[model samples]
Target: MEWIIGIGVCAVLVVIFTIVTYNKLVSLKNRFQNAFAQIDVQLTRRYDLIPNLVETAKAYMTHERETLEAVIAARNQASSGLRKAAADPGNPEAMKALAVAEQGLGGMLGRFMALSESYPQLQASENMKQLSEELSSTENRVAFARQAYNDAVMTYNVKREQFPANIVASQFRFTAAALLEIEDQAKRQVPKVSFS
Candidate 1:
């Protein structure tokens, strides 16, 4: 009779542990999902600002139509990437594609800004100044959102990998989430200076 009681108690404890572990994992995953949503919102705002910036610059940059067109193309590619990443924020491949697209867009925008420097009238336009300010503000917001998302992902991944949680996570098929890192585009090599 004592052995029967012991077996019942052990079974109860095992069930309780499994339930708790599953709940914790679910909570962690949801947190990261929410974080990703914040990033999406900010990125959408950033993408929206791109067109206004391009349009304002258009009034002054008549001869630089090709550069303007390239910027638009990069923006479109980045937008497409956002859709894919939003569909599966934790997927490694989706996140990588988004990062690459963003990097390309950044490079294009950098070139656009450099070219605009040659046109004093464009640089001094009130509309251009306003759009530039908004873009700069949006960039800051994106950086913050990305940091929050990465932090949440790190927490979720650690929890999923820990001892007993690992057992439950595997059984329940909890996959590791990838980090979203949007790095700056690589710069061109500097020319060597020769003094003969």
Candidate 2:
């Protein structure tokens, strides 16, 4: 009779442990997802600002059609990549695609800015100045959001990989999360937007 009671108690404890681990994994997953959402908001804001900047420059850069078009194309690709990553923020392939697309966009924007410097009228335009300020602000916000997301992902991943928690994670099919890192060395630099 005592052995029966001991068995029952052990079983209950095992169940409780499993439940706790599962709940923790879920909570961490949710936290990282929320972090990704913050990044999404900032990137969305950045994407929205691109077209306005392009339009403002279009007036002053009549001969720079190819560069303008390239910028728009890169923006569209980056937008698509953002949608994919937002759907599953830490999926390896999706995050990789987002990073590449972002790199392309950054390159195009840099070229556009360098060209814009040639047009004195475009540099002095009030609309261009305002857009540059907003883009710079959005870039800072994105950097913060990305750091928060990476931190959350690292925490969640470490928790998921821990001994007893790893057992529960595998049982529950909790996948590993990927970090959002820039792939290219040159692309690591954010475009310098100066309207001064």
Candidate 3:
């Protein structure tokens, strides 16, 4: 009789433990999903802002038509990549595609900004100024969102990989997610400064 009671208690404890671990994994996954959604919102805002910025600069940047078109094309590609990544944030290939697309868009935007510097009329325009300010603000928001997403991902990954949780994770097929990375060496490099 005592042996039967002991066996039942052990079985109940094991079931409880499994349930707790599974719930924890689910919670962490949800947090990661929420963080990615924030990134998506910021990226969507950026995509919408690009057209206005391009239009504002177009009047004064008539000679730079190719640059303008390149920016638009890059923006479209990034938008598509973002959609794919958001659909499956855990897919490394999709994340890499989005990262590359974003890098290309950044490069194109950098070139457009550099070219605008040579056009005094574009720089002085009120519409351009407003659009530039908005874009800068949106970029900052995107950076913050990315940082938050990365942090959440790191935490979730750590939890998923820890000893007992790892057992549950493997049994449940809780795959790891990819981080948003910058693939551009130029973007990673620090700008050279000269005081002289």
Candidate 4:
């Protein structure tokens, strides 16, 4: 009868809907992983450049040896952070440590540049200029990558927390991912830089 056919159609539609929802969840999960991978790529580049930047500064400004050492130490700490993050990307502590290390490294870089400013010849050196430019580019890339990763995390987290999606996410063990947090309270406050 017509009632039997209607029932069959409803059941088929439900099955199709479930399959589509499951596939969408899988796609979102993959996007989250891809975003994290992008961040990892940029961080690796930044780490590789840190040593060269420190060495270049050391050669130009011998008196800034302490600053260079600090940078190196921060780099080591950050490297450890990267390892921890890689081992467990969901670990919030690793993210915090990495953020602190990054801030420390940034402060050391500022000091290195300030110290370099004292030496006009060093500033004008071809090698120094190239290194400075490279570091600046790396910083920009890091910022871009961070933004991309955060955006992806936001998308995934939202999807996983939604009503029906939450059910699917829980079944798949898709937990929320942590963002790279700013650890230093002082650094949390934004400083205004005036061009005037």
Which candidate number maximizes TM-score? 3
Model 1 scores worst on lDDT over the 10 consecutive residues at: 183-192
Q: Would you list the C-alpha lDDT of every candidate in the order shown?
A: 0.92, 0.94, 0.91, 0.76
Candidate 4, residues 61-155, lDDT tens digits: the string is 88777877887887788778877776665456877777787777777767777877997878888878887888889878878877776777778
The CA-based lDDT of model 4 is what? 0.76
TM-score of each: 0.92, 0.92, 0.94, 0.81
* Candidate number with the higher lDDT (3 or 4): 3
- Models sorted by lDDT, best on top: 2, 1, 3, 4
Model 3 per-residue lDDT at 4: 100
For candidate 3, the 10 contiguous residues with the lowest summed lDDT are 179-188
> For this target, which candidate reaches the highest lDDT against the unseen true structure?
2
lDDT of 3: 0.91
lDDT at 107, model 1? 92
TM-score of 4: 0.81
Model 1 accuracy (lDDT, Cα): 0.92
Clashing residue pairs in candidate 2 are none
